[model samples]
Target: MTYKAVFFDIDGTLVNEEKEIPQDTIEAIAQLKESGIDVFIATGRAPYYFQHYAKPLGIDSFVSFNGSYVVYKGKVVHEHPIPEKTLELLESTALANNHPIVMQGAEAGYANYPTTRSIRSLPNRSMICVLRCPATEAATGRRRRCTKRCCIAKLTRNRCTRRPKLRSVT
Candidate 1:
């Protein structure tokens, strides 16, 4: 059996723990493309972060944001944004839990904390909106700080209540 397309996860599959892509992986991808097989990336990370690696690796298609977004040949094929109500609930829960929240969007990301190396690694750091909690709202805006109650399990349970509808682009 032959596969027409191949998808690889960025973090550990294509890139190592040290964040370096092995030369063999790059060569293999090139060989696949030369042989008429399509190579793509499927990652939970925002698209911009992996863009620099895409072209060099001969990847033109992607499934990003844990499959919430999809792009093919520089064109967006699908997208899905979390509902406003759900986002609000998440923000409130995070605030109550004192957990720092980082919201990833299609083009950029938003964080409720200072810019860290991890956050800075995004393609466009300037696009990331820094949200300030009520305590620091005076200096920023109407953001709230995430407290200790912002457990991942609780947040996951809350978000699972409603699935975001996928928006297809022709």
Candidate 2:
């Protein structure tokens, strides 16, 4: 039997702590493509966080945010957005606990508490935008507006890379 496609996790698999892909890995991926295996990225990171890697790795398709969002050949094929009620509950919970929340979407990383140590420690954190919860989205609309999301809130349950599945807002 032969595999037609290969999926790779971004962090510590394709890239190291410094977020750099080794030359050997690049060459190996090139060789895989030469042999006709389609390479794709399957990462917990949001699409915007890892979009830059696509060009170098020759990957056009990916499963991001830990399978919560999927883009096949530059088109979003799957998604699991958090319901509006759930998000509101989270916001209130985080507020009560005084925990910061950092959200991830296809466009950018959104943060509720910008000065948290979690957001400040990152080198590329300048990209994160400080915003309130679900305010920017239209006041009344049937369509949800969000692709992916990550929350750095200090919580004790249901953690996936310390992020909540944020797919859409009211």
lDDT, candidate 1, residue 130? 36
TM-score of 1: 0.64
Stretches > 4 Å off in candidate 2: 96-98, 116-170
lDDT of each: 0.64, 0.65
* Native-to-model Cα distance after best TM-score fit, residue 68 in candidate 1, in Å: 0.9
State in Å the error of residue 53, model 1: 1.6
List of clashing residue pairs for candidate 2:
81-167, 104-150
**What tens-digit string does per-residue lDDT give for candidate 1 at 1-170?**
88898999988789988888998898899889898887889987777678878877768799987888898877888888776566767766765786667666655555555357855666656333333323344445555543423311112222211222312110
Cα misplacement distance, residue 105 of candidate 2 (Å):
1.7
Give me the candidate number with maximum lDDT.
2
Candidate number of the best TM-score = 2
Root mean square deviation (Cα) for candidate 2:
9.6
TM-score for all models, in order of appearance: 0.64, 0.66
Candidate 1 versus truth, CA RMSD in Å, comes to 9.1
